[model samples]
Target: MLESLLWGAVAAAPLVLGAVLAGIRAWPDRLLGIVLGFGAGALIASIAFELWQDGLEQGGPVPLAIGVALGAAVYFTADRLVERWAKRAGGGAAAGVPLALGALLDGIPEQLVLGFGLADGAGVSVALVVAIFVSNLPESIGSSSDLLDGGVKRPAVLGIWSAVAALCALSTVAGWALADVASASIRTGLNGFAAGALLVMMVDSMIPEAQKRAKDLAGVATVFGFALAAGLSALGG
Candidate 1:
């Protein structure tokens, strides 16, 4: 448990870095997109090649199907609700609350997957945590900045981010605990579902953000991120 929590902290490091970066200078929207895209691509690839594959090898088709469906449903539903709330809030001070809430919720599954991976094995968990930490940094910073730009106080912004971070950590703990007692088939299903959900998130959030930054840069970053993740996966394996 201690090791898993430590790994979770490591996984969240990128998010903390990104939040700090957001305070540095005005990042071009397109550049942001590119960076996020690369990160997302890496995440998707890692999920597919590492986690999902292992799950399938462990349990077979039923687990994969159940996991995929559950993950997709959870991601899509949560996203839709958040989008609606954000849209209703519009571009005002009040918008910050919903935006922060949405971003926090969006991070839950990622944390859950991180914990699940760790519970499975140290090598796999470490690789996934590192990759995810790298990916999450920009997002945390960007989201915090967005809230600040929308007129949220700095203290409030930090508080909300901290809370969200705590929630993410909690999710990982929960996932680790649940996975410990779960059947092999259930574990496989959960991992598969997580991969599916992560893929959707990458498409919906990370890729769009990266593309909005700089198309060429985003493309390069995406490739580089995937390569880096692949290397990490190999090392871990």
Candidate 2:
């Protein structure tokens, strides 16, 4: 469990790093969009190669499907409610909350999946870690920058991202502990759930946000991210 928590923090470290970079200076919207695009691509690759594929290998279609449906429903409903709450609690830059919150929601399951992967004594999945770290960097950077632009205090932005990162690390520990005693089908379902959540997040937040800024360049950046992650996975194998 300790190992899982440590590794989870290692993977989520990029969020804090990204937030720090945002604190250092304001980022141009176009550049931020490009970064978001790349992250989206990397995240998609993770869902395909790391999460979904592995879930199928572990428990087959039925469990995977059920997990995916549940995940999507949970994320969609929760995200909408959070958005409403943030709107009601409007402050200087509360707009940033939705984005950061989305990242948090996305990260928890992902880190949990990481913990699950480690539970089997198979060692860590280098590909998944790389994908997550790469993907999370842009998310924090973009969201933190947005908060700053919206007149949010720097410390608050950093604090939010840091807290979310910590939560994700704890989630990894939870996954590891649960997986230790879970049936094979349950493990597969969990992976599927993570994958489903990831897919929804990309569509709901990352991709649209990216395209909102860089437009044409966003597509290219996405391809670059995907190719890079895929290449890394191949090499790791």
Candidate 1 residues lying further than 4 Å off, grouped into runs, are 91-128
- TM-score winner: 2
TM-score quality measure for candidate 2: 0.90
| C-alpha lDDT values of all predictions | 0.66, 0.80
Estimate the TM-score of every prediction.
0.79, 0.90
lDDT, candidate 1, 40-103, per-residue tens: 6676567767767777887888888888788777777877776776678774554334334434
Which run of 10 residues does model 1 get worst, by summed lDDT? 94-103
Lowest-sum lDDT 10-residue window in model 2: 90-99
lDDT of candidate 2 over 1-237, digit per residue (tens): 789988989988988999899999878889999999998888777777767887888889899899888778877887788677667777545655655766776678777777777886768767656766777898888888878887889899889999999998898888888876877688777777777777787788779989998999999999999888877766555
- How many angstroms is residue 44 displaced in model 1 relative to the true structure, after the best TM-score fit? 2.1
Off by over 4 Å in 2: 90-92, 125-127
